[model samples]
Target: MYKKSKIALAIGLSVGLATTAGAAETNWRMATPWSGGPWLERDAQMFADHVNDLSGGEIEIEIFPGGTLGSALKVTNSVKSGVADISHNYINYDYGTDPTTALLAGHSSGLTPEEFMMWMYQGGGVELYEEYRRDMFDVVAFPCAILGTEIFLHSNKRVETLEDFQGLRLRTSGAWSELASRLGASTVVMSGGDIYSALERGVIDAAEWGSPEMNRPTGFQEVAQYVIVPGVHQSGGFLECQVNEEVWTGLSEDEQDNLRLAGKLSVFESWLASSYDDLDAYEELVSGENEIVHLDQDFIDTIYEETAKWEDEYAEDNEWFARVLESQRDFKETMSAWPEYRLPIGTMGR
Candidate 1:
């Protein structure tokens, strides 16, 4: 009877392998919201390389640069409906799909770049959507890339004070736009593609687009006279990885593990890489090639404090925001020990 049981178990395992073998190639299509510039191209390539390498060519994802397959909006929905196998986008782009999806997108909430990373990875924030983000979006939640922190105010007009934002036509997205409206600005929602023409043509006086390297591709240099620092609107933001559900489910346990590891590494890469870019951009902006204006440091301190208050108040109304904030704050506290352990040793080595 024991031998019979062993034989039955072996047969079941064999059948499972046979079923997986009969499954089709785990090929996928992947795209990002922004045009496939340096970071996007590198990230998409990393995903393809790692997945293909780990899967032994069983799973392949063809990279589509911006608008090649469809818009950023379409990409998210496409992945959801299994029209696409994977996606790289800001989850906040799908604010309509579910408010909670925006948690990692980093539109609001008083998260610094490191805090946001910690919150998403160690803070139990992503787990809140383990069902919807992991299942409904038909993908695993990989906090793949971070745009660093953004500074608000790329205005056609000078915004010296919060009151100066009143009646100013500005381009924004996510819950932060609502906060901008409350503060004074008339918010005009836009896709990333539309921002350039709108700002150039004076359709909008100001806009907030981060990622210093990415903005260079759009010729924001040509039109927008001023770029302010300390992005009050987006102190931090993130890019989400939405793996194709069927393709992911088909992956062996080892392959799934590699994909996740790859995602976390990608986020670290983004974090390290963008810090350099911001410094470089700031140097260029101040070189007088561009008419860059720095907001007063005092003003920045004020912005940070006020936004924190706004975030708490905003959380009061939105249950999702409240949960995200609490989760993120907890993550930050947990990581307080990390700086002591990691930074000092690294600096000594350097």
Candidate 2:
């Protein structure tokens, strides 16, 4: 009887250890800033799926969409406090802590979305960003989603020239808010979830979000009749995934490589996905009640000039901003000759 009891006890201990090991494998909780739309939601899901596949199911990331966990602006703090193991975030949202977040988030007017991504991947921007995240926020981050060129504004009133910005109550973020405020627009800071309600209630006259594809699902068109194109404020903005520093350090080197691969894959796939949606949405808006306004070239030039001036002023005061600006500008200059040298093959200058 004693021998039989000992064997059964040993078997129970083995089963308990197996169960605990399985439970320990899934170690991450990735939270999204907003209850994401299809485009954003797809990327998050893809990232999670890739990590799981790469780790052979040894690591699992559970996603919580929306401010379901907390406010978007508080994501950095949430990660720091380990309320979330990781988060899909926009560094620009945390500009209250460091104005340099605008530069890292790629808010400048000069580069195209693709060029901005190149800067991050090849032009030393990623190193600077990683250093900033570590030193300032004590978090680990990567440029996980490339939003590309965003729409300038969805406005209740048509905007054709610089003067149109005057006296309009607009919802904007980062340094663009300062520039817009200088141009006489009253800039209001609000989250994506709050934009429609704000517009519906006459609280804001205009708001700027990502590409039309990304914006259409938000139903901004139902509230605002005019769509401003050629996003001057957010030409090449992208989003980042931030992980708790402790959590990141605990990851295996192979797991780190897989995470980076997932980010790169999402960047390319997101642009491709959003392009189709944007074309379809653009056609629908033009064919329907909303009017698309292409800001005139001369007015666009003025915006470019204003943005240049803003960059200089910000760089002068913030050392972090200055370093990033200098690096991006250098990369931009190096790549300037390529487009001119390569002949346009399809739809060039159209």
Candidate 3:
């Protein structure tokens, strides 16, 4: 009787797999926090297109740009609850789920986006991410978009030194906010959608949204006159696409492979597009109306010093955070050496 039961269970599993295989197509709903901004939004669209093409229309992803379904910050929950099958969103917004998320969600890790991607793809970063995700959230993840280093701060008033940050009300989030608070700035957390009105109403004296390309469409320049370069707070980061675990597991192997490939393609596409967009947007800011301010090197050095201190303290208290942090530090130490000796392409005029 026990052997019969085992055979019956195996047959049931085979039937379920066969039924799933026989399905003609699968439709998925994808949501994003942004209002379909050019960079991230474009990447999402391309990813969807790639999946469709690769799977021969076996998988169709309908994107809901902006917080049309719910608050942007609620994306992870939305996916978990099956309200949306997937989310193309920033991990920093989900740091509440697990503080270790900051390790990937734009900590001041001193690695540029390219370097971070290298660590993620080749140096065990993705494995670390998957371990954390399994513990903290029920979703399958992929790094769908990668951004260049951002313009650090945008202020209504000119800010050039560490002294300028003291008592300043800055709108930010994640690790950067923590670092800024330690540097004597008051940090306020708000959605990117809320920043404009807040800036106009004096709710925040300064903000650090994203790259100039991402910010230009929001009209930050209309209100903030000073634009600080080289985002020391967030050297580089990725926008991830996370799918519900059930939905991800339900897909066939080929379908799963297509999604993975699409995500990787999106990363490469976003990187290339952002380079051009950032260059043009930055030139416009510098030559146009706003006062372009470069942060003092000494002040930046101090910010890094403080960032290191925070990392040490946090790692001591949080094992997961330390695990990811130590791995990245180990990878970056040797990786950084290559760029230092190579051609000065990255340091030509800067």
Candidate 4:
């Protein structure tokens, strides 16, 4: 009888342990807009890996690259609708759903990468983002990656002044396209895959894609001769990770915290890795056949002025845009003291 009782007790304990483990384990699908082999895609994967490690295997996430699950632009919708448990994407991709997202994604003459980080993490930007996503899409969202300044334009025609943009055929998107039009350029919107062919065929005079590291692999140098500097359109940008509201709510508080930490870690690592790679890519571009054209300061100032006017006009009509724009401008003003206090620094290797 004693042996039988001991056996029964052992069986009960094993069953309880199994049940607990089953309840703790969770599997999720993460959809991203980035294709394979780019830092953007790797960053999303890294976040998933970090979540798995941090959660002690309690959670596992699988990454689906761009177009694998659905249209990249609809990733947020996929997550919200449960097609994907989570998604990694740019906030601007949802601009059609809400114009406020354009400002969230970083605009011309907006926050630099460092300032944007400070604004997002410390200056209530994260809370605002969460509020916006929750109300707009019924999802939980946070920035998972921060990218540095992008290349202004890769062109066959030289563009140094505002006058040079006159009648120039440029391929771009979002607010930049509008700005380009305002500057007298005939702007065309096309996918990144189509840029090289368009440039080679003289269908577009110029195009703005990404930073040096991100653009090099696309072989822009082989087709475009001029590499313009200072991407005023997108000085910096944020990639976000969004979770389905139901999935987020189902997680334990500890699991939720782990996901947030994983995102922050991914952001830090990706920023450093991409920034260093961009430096190397820039050096290569300088030595390669493509001519580097630095936009004149006067032209850059004119762009800033026009950007301010564009944002102000949009903000006048959009309450959320106004609020976000106010927050960013306030942060920029508050942090303006640092540049004055510190000694001026030159470009790397200058």
* Candidate 4 residue lDDT tens string, 226-306: 999988889987888999999999876756766776677777777877788889999999999989999988988988899
Candidate-wise lDDT, in order: 0.67, 0.77, 0.79, 0.81
Ranking according to TM-score, highest score first: 4, 3, 2, 1
Candidate 3, residue 96: CA error in Å? 1.9
lDDT for model 3, please: 0.79
TM-score per prediction, in order, is 0.80, 0.88, 0.90, 0.90
Worst 10 residues of 4 by lDDT: 1-10
Better of 2 and 4 by TM-score: 4
The residue-by-residue lDDT of candidate 3 on 220-298, one tens digit each, is 8888888987788888888888889999888777567656766777777778888788889998998989999998998
The sequence of per-residue lDDT tens digits that candidate 1 reaches over residues 172-197 is 87776766777677899987788889
Off by over 4 Å in 2: 1-24, 343-350
Each candidate's clash count: 3, 2, 0, 0
List RMSD in Å for every model shown: 8.6, 9.2, 8.7, 8.5
List candidate 1 stretches off by more than 4 Å. Answer: 1-25, 135-138, 296-320, 332-350
Q: Give candidate 4's error at residue 290 in angstroms.
A: 0.9
lDDT of 4 at 173: 80
